[model samples]
Structures are given as structure tokens and as C-alpha cells.
Target: MIRVVAVLALLRLAAITVAALPVQWVALRLGSSLADRLPVWWHRRALATLGVRVTPRGTPSSERPLLITANHASWLDISVIGSLGPVSFVAKSEVATWPVFGLLAKLQRCVFVDRTRRSATGRTAGELGDRLAAGDPMVLFPEGTSSPGDGVLPFRSALLGAARAAILDSGHTRVVVQPMAVVYTRIGGMPIGRADRHRVAWYGDMDLIGHLWGVCIAGGLDVEVVWGEPQIFEATTDRKALAATLETSVRDQLRAVLRP
Candidate 1:
């Protein structure tokens, strides 16, 4: 029965990828004005393929210059949140060169940054700010990498500088930073524990294809997306301090949501 489900998912994924072409072309041709309202369809398609149901908490921001910081759980985090609303992602620089996922990220207008190079940090943040100033809300995973569905990692303060630049220089003082937490709660309509969760969260050195295979054969993938209250960053606020606070809030939220 599980094998049958996995095969079905693989077929669905292939079809969705093909169907996204026209949508991508039209959105890009119009200067990406349709961009902020796009990608939800792809997220829906991804959900259908992966058998993952995302239950969102708290409302997304209604204003421009929004930054969403989510704890990275599985690769599925992308589709879960992207499916929630139309939002771009701040992914690692190597993602731009990845196989098929890279193209999808570019189509979604993702901002890629090279963490090893200090020179690129400002450039990447500038790009993020440019998108925000252009009224595009972006999602950034501050852990710099995905972790097992165990606990939220302490966020790196380096990337939070992007939020500071946008609010201070761009005159967008009230920019909203929405902290999000993703927790895989159940499988096959039953509760999943730490050992079983490995089928979902793909961490260090985990091969993508193998992870997908394992996930596909598993029961349903259920993710709880908890969005913390919207925080307004101003010039008077210390950026790093605010970032740390946001990190703690999100970590707490994740722990709360994951409590058994």
C-alpha cells in the first residue's frame, strides 16, 4: 500500500513541475508584479504530491517589507510555508546551482547568499531589501541549515542585518518580522515520535533522493506552521538584540507546538 502511494506521489510531482511553466513565464514577464501573489499554487501542488497537510497558525502580515524567519525542519518546510502564501525565500547560494530545485527557487524569486564569503552578505541583504522595498515578502531560514525535527537551533545574527537595512534606510520603519515554527506532528493519522520523525526531517549529509523515498513510503506528512506575533523593527531598536529576541520567541513557539 505504501509503495503504491509513493509511486503516485512521484507521478504527481512530475506533472506539477511541467504545469508550472506558463505560470512562471507570465508572472516574470510582467515585471513580477504578480509575484507577491504567486507561488501558492505551486505550494498546493507540492502538498498534493507529498501528502503533507500544513495547518497555519497566526496571520501573515498584510504590509510590504515583511521578513519571515522560520526554523528549518525538513526540505518540506519550503512547500509548507510557500503553500501558505506567496513569499520568496532566502536560501543558500548553492541552491541556485542545484538541479531542479534551483530553477524552482529562481522562479519563486528566491534570494541566494554565500555564507562563507563576507563580501556577499551585504550584497545578498541588499537584494533582499530591494525585494522588500519592491513590496515582496521574503522567507528566511536563519539556522543556515536544516535540523532534525527535535529542537530549534539558535539563529545566526548575521542574516538579521538585512531586516535592519530595509527598515532603517528604506524608510520602512514598521517592517514586520514574522517568526515561524514548523513541527511534524502525525503520521498515518497517528502520533509520530522522535525515531519515526527521522523519516521526515532530513539533516546533515542526508541525501535528498533517499530522504524523499523514505518520506514517500511513510505515512502522511503533517506539519504545524506556527507564526509568532508580528514584530516591528525601528531605528531605535538594536537589530541584533531584536533578532535574538525573535529567535527565542520562535524557538519557544516551536517547543510549545511540539509538546506532546
Candidate 2:
């Protein structure tokens, strides 16, 4: 199983290396259509090759200025969600420095925010607003950190301020704020207990390489993605209140997935 996982990982690396450069060049010279579509193709392949089965509920909103707020469990959340469409992400600025993952995020045109800089919030929000206004759906993990997948952490409402920025910057009366949930419900065709589920979660001080290797060898993993009803974010909307609403919806969805 380890050998199989290693070979698959290498093959994925090779595929990304071969396809990413050309796709990025085309996206830059032409437009984002190729860049957007190609990653979905790659992610789908990666999901299958990694032996992850994703079952998504409800579709992402087609409305412009869409911002998806989701719970963070592990890095696998990215691939599971990316497999859905041509969406980009709002990631921590540090991700920009990660080797291959960083490059991939850049190619996907992710909006990176420096969470430590108090003064950078406005600037980051403005950037996210610009992306939203441009019709690029952006995803944000509002918990500010990954969780253990047993439950959700309170959503940090500060970043939700970007929705207001989008409304004002774009002069759009309304923006769509979608609540999404990613739950690891099963492993090896059986319902996973809490202790077992932790194997799928990458949090605390877990080493990335070790986690990745574990995930590769852990076949028959099943993840369920639930998209809550899209809410409206207006210029007058209270960001923290809106964050609370999304938190409730995501928790409900997560509970549903984890229920026996």
C-alpha cells in the first residue's frame, strides 16, 4: 500500500509539472478559462487517484460576487472543493511560500491574506472584493485554522468583512455568501468513529509530509460536502452576525454527515 501510494504521488507530481506550466501560460496570455477548467480536471484525477470518494450536496451558487465560507478540516478540503468547479480560494499569505502547493494556489489565482497584520485587513478585503466583483467565486475557511473534524470552531468574523468590501467596492447591492461543510464520514466502507476519523484530519502540529503519506495509504476514504442555502450579503449587513448565521448552517450540515 505504501509503494502504491508513493507511485501515485509521484505520478501526480509529474502530471502537475507537465500540465501546470502550459496551462498557466495560456491562462495568462489568453484568459482564466483554461486555468480555471484545467485545475478541476487535475483535481478530479487526483481525488480518484488518491482513493477519495467525494459526495457533494447542493451546488455552488452561480450568482456573481460569490464567497463560500467553509469549515477547515485538512488540506484535502481543497481538492474536494476544487473538484466542484473553476473556483479559487482565499488562503493565508504563508501558503504562497509553500513549494508546489504555493505554485498551484497562484495558478488558481488564490487571494492570500496576511492574518497577522492588523493594517492589512482592509487591503486584503479590498483584494477579495475585487476578485468577487470580477465573478471569480472565492472560498474562505473562516475558522482561521483547521479543526479535528469532530466539530466546528467559531468562525472569525473579521474576514467576513470582505463581503462588505465587495458590496461597496463593486457597488453591487448584494453578494452571495454560501456556507459549506466538508465531513469525513467513512473509511474502508464503514462509519468512522471519532478516534479513527482523526486519521483523516491534519491539524495541531502535524507534519505535512507524514500526513500526506498517511492519507495516500488510507484508501476507501469517503467525504461528504454540503452546501448550505446561499445567503445575501448587502452593504448594510453586519459581518459578525452574518458569520454567526453561516456557522450555524455549517454546523448543521456537519452534524448531518456525522450522524449515525
lDDT per residue (tens digit) for residues 147-194 in model 2: 899799999988787557755767787889999999998876778787
- What are the RMSD figures for all models against the true structure? 1.7, 1.6
**Full-model lDDT, candidate 2:** 0.85
Candidate 2 deviant stretches above 4 angstroms: none
Q: Estimate the overall C-alpha local distance difference test score of candidate 1.
A: 0.81
At residue 74, give the lDDT of candidate 2.
Answer: 92
- 167 in model 2: Cα distance from truth in Å? 2.8
lDDT of 1 by residue, 1-260 (tens): 87988998988888888778667868798867565555788788878777888888887778667888888978888888888877889999888998888888888889999988988988888888888777778898988899887788878877677557755677776677888888888877877788887788888888988998887877777788888888887667677787788889888887887774
Model 1 residue 254 CA deviation in Å: 1.3
TM-score of each: 0.94, 0.94
Best model per lDDT: 2
